[model samples]
Target: MFRLKTMIGLFAGALMLTAGISQASATELRIASGFGDNHSATRALREVFARKVEELTDGRYTVSVFPNSELGQATEMVNQAQSGINFGVYVSSAFYNSQVPELGVTNLPFVFPDRETAFKVFDGPFGDKFKPLFEKSGLVVLGYMELGFRNVTNSVRKIAEPADLKGLKIRLQNNPVHIATFRQLGANPVSIDGSEMFAALSQGVVDAQENPYSVINAFRLYDAGQKYMSDTGHFFDVIVFAGSKSMLDAMSAEDRQAILNAGRLATEAQRKFAKEDEAADLKSILSHGVTFTRLTPEEREDFRKATLPVYDLVRERLGAGLVDEFLADVDAAK
Candidate 1:
């Protein structure tokens, strides 16, 4: 009995010591994203944000990065953050549109003419105006990272013109604008979650899909039997880093500032990484035997024109007032 009691006492003491240390030292936070660890977004979170947070906080806080939907899908991760179960999650702007509505303004087809224009809008006054939309949805926007311009990948046919998309079934991000846009372009658009995209393409459940080159390579859509890719540059996307307001409010002011700084630095790094990896990813995808097709400026304008009707639906869904305000921002960016 004495030996058992001594062991129990020591174990209890150790537990108490651990609890005390945990209380006094750094707070640990889990950050999650739907993309793979090899992805630039995840790499930024792991290397830039996570490291910078620790450095900025002077070891007062540490972050654990979970990639490839290890924690959950994007929607589930957003719920986790909103409920304060996790510190942060990377979410798509289109996903936010499903909740906030007005956020879909960014999803308008061909709104951003190029990468430079996108950066100006998202990092400048446009980003500032849009960031507050998350607060109403139980999230606080940390910063934005590029997902790059989306292009078409197909096992069926090469898309050189809007007419070429006529009979193909294309998988799109779960955004109404994307679906409507493709539908108007005469292709059947199927809204599928990112996790299920590969199998859908592999089994021919969908004849085609559109995404950035980074996504095409990261997800290995080529390995899934995708034979052709088009540089349509139809839509440019940015991933939003969002946090739980309650969780952030629980932090010390200094710690909160550290997180904000870390997020801003990570955004810059993530954008740079995404842009830098584009040409290489395109080459990597092509080396796998997929035919690469680049749309001419006239061909791209054809697509732009075909999708113009999409803006009316967007304005109706997101409200004309919000759409006008965002268009002004888009114009200002140019």
Candidate 2:
């Protein structure tokens, strides 16, 4: 009986040791985004990125995603990721412009005439230039996802030409290039946080706003009294997937690779989803009795010409030489 009891004690100790080892091998990571949970980018992060990370890491790592600003607003979340408070962030590239001013080149009006050209530039050398800048800021650029082309929406009337936008109060992101573009187009660009955009529009704080179809649909901005939408395609926005450099550096090589691989897969999935859903989102928006304006080539050209000075503003902020290189690269990609 004494021998049997000793054997049982040994067995229990071994089992406890194995359980502890298993627990220690598993890691949990947190990813944050300011987009709504239903947004395609958030969905891609949760469904594809997070899942792929777990699978690629053989269940050794798990990711928890906090969407809809549960972690904080876009800029705050960026700070958290920089400080390693969060493992990663998926937010607008515009949000990173403050940290890497050269990144604002992507936000230049009408730089990308279509999604194909935008993807080529971003996935090519032009996009590669910003990786080191992000690294200098203690962040890793995992991948760039599509936020699609930004369009103008207003409660007052259809913006068929640049002159139509004159004197209208428009809510815009806190992006200098965006603000300058609208200002040059003769609209009163009011910088508003994304969280406050709906209220500002609904309560008449702003008469107009611009965003991609995905954001418009996800936020249900149509319900906020926006009665008109035009395909301005002023800016083709990109959502960046960035990881905390310190956190990633601390991770094992295999684990870091797993995260990067997951980022690539998620980015591809998101771009596809956003492109496919654009038409559906537009249809849904118009179903709410919103008038839609499809600008003719001449009309688009007029708006584009009016916003051309925005390029000069960009060159001033980010040197004429670099801007020239970027524009040349854009042309080559096209």
Tens-place lDDT per residue, model 2, 1-334, is 9999999999999999997887688887898987888788888888999899989988888888998889877898888999999889888888887678888888889888899998998999888989999999989998899988999999998889999999999999888899999999999999887878899999999999999988888889999999999999999999988999998999899989999999999999999888888999998898888899999999999988888888888888889998899889889988
Look at candidate 1 and tell me the lDDT of residue 94.
Answer: 70
Residue pairs with backbone overlap in model 2: none
Candidate closest to the true structure, highest lDDT: 2
Task: Please list the residue runs of candidate 2 whose C-alpha ends up more than 4 Å from where it truly belongs after superposition.
Answer: 1-25
Candidate 1 similarity to native, TM-score:
0.91
Q: What TM-score would candidate 2 get against the native?
A: 0.93
Model 1 clash pairs are none
lDDT string for model 1 (22-107, tens) is 65787888888878877888899889999999899877788998888888877888888888899888867777764566667788
In order of appearance, the predictions have TM-scores of 0.91, 0.93
